[model samples]
Target: MHRLILSLLIASLAACSHTPSVPLYRQLGGPDGIQDIVGRTLTRVAQHPTAGRTFKGVKMPFLVDSVSKYVCKVADGPCVYEGENMVRAHADLGLQGSEFDVMVSVLREELDRAGVGDAAKNELLRRLAPSRRDMVQR
Candidate 1:
């Protein structure tokens, strides 16, 4: 009886370990997915008059490179995000909470349109939600 109980406990523990966390990179289809989403997002944001204006005089390529790198790193892909700190990056931009919220919402929509699975979406959002805390000016 003691041996049976120990075996059952071990089996349960092993099952739990394989239960699976949503992978940040794989669900988005890895590197290709990230690039696709980036393109769609840039188009969405660019179409918005306000956001389009915000990009004026800003180094667009640099910004996109930074975004790609950041996403790649977060997704556990083989890339380094050599961008400035989140707080410093947007410090002078004077981003508003509402604006950030709109951007995030738009991003979510793009991800869905790209057929990103719910698990991946939830996991990615879980990872990025904290950024809003620092992005919005008090």
Candidate 2:
């Protein structure tokens, strides 16, 4: 009986180990949720006194689509990001740290508005944190 119980425990542990948690993309409500977050974030950035100037004369629909695709890919969704790499994309922008911070703040606000939980938000932020180096020149 003791041996049988031990085998059962091992089997349970193995099963637990094999269980896969849902990806963050699905946690953030998939494509629709990502689109909503991106839309709100872009709107806020465009309205921001400092950030707005950077977007002047930019093609907003293309920007929106690219950003949405990037976010979706980063979150492990099915979408693919075909846009330029971060360093290449923002290289000419000469973004300042403060401007980057403002953008992040706006994104955070939109995420919260989308009802994203702390765990998911933190996870997403962690994934995006590396892009800061590419985005900020000053």
**Candidate topping lDDT:** 2
* Model 2 regions lying over 4 Å from their true place: 2-20
lDDT for each residue of candidate 1 in 3-68, tens digit (9 for 90 to 100): 999999999999988958656776887777887787678667756766555566776667777787
What is the overall TM-score of model 2 with all chains considered together?
0.88
Q: Against the hidden true structure, what lDDT does model 2 obtain?
A: 0.90
TM-score of each model, paired residue for residue:
0.78, 0.88
Q: How far out, in Å, is residue 38 in model 2? A: 0.5
- What TM-score should be assigned to candidate 1? 0.78
Give the Cα RMSD of candidate 2.
2.3
Superposed on all Cα atoms, model 1 deviates from the true structure by an RMSD in Å of 3.2
Q: Supply candidate 2's per-residue lDDT for 47.
A: 82
Q: Please count the clashing residue pairs in each candidate, in the order shown.
A: 0, 0
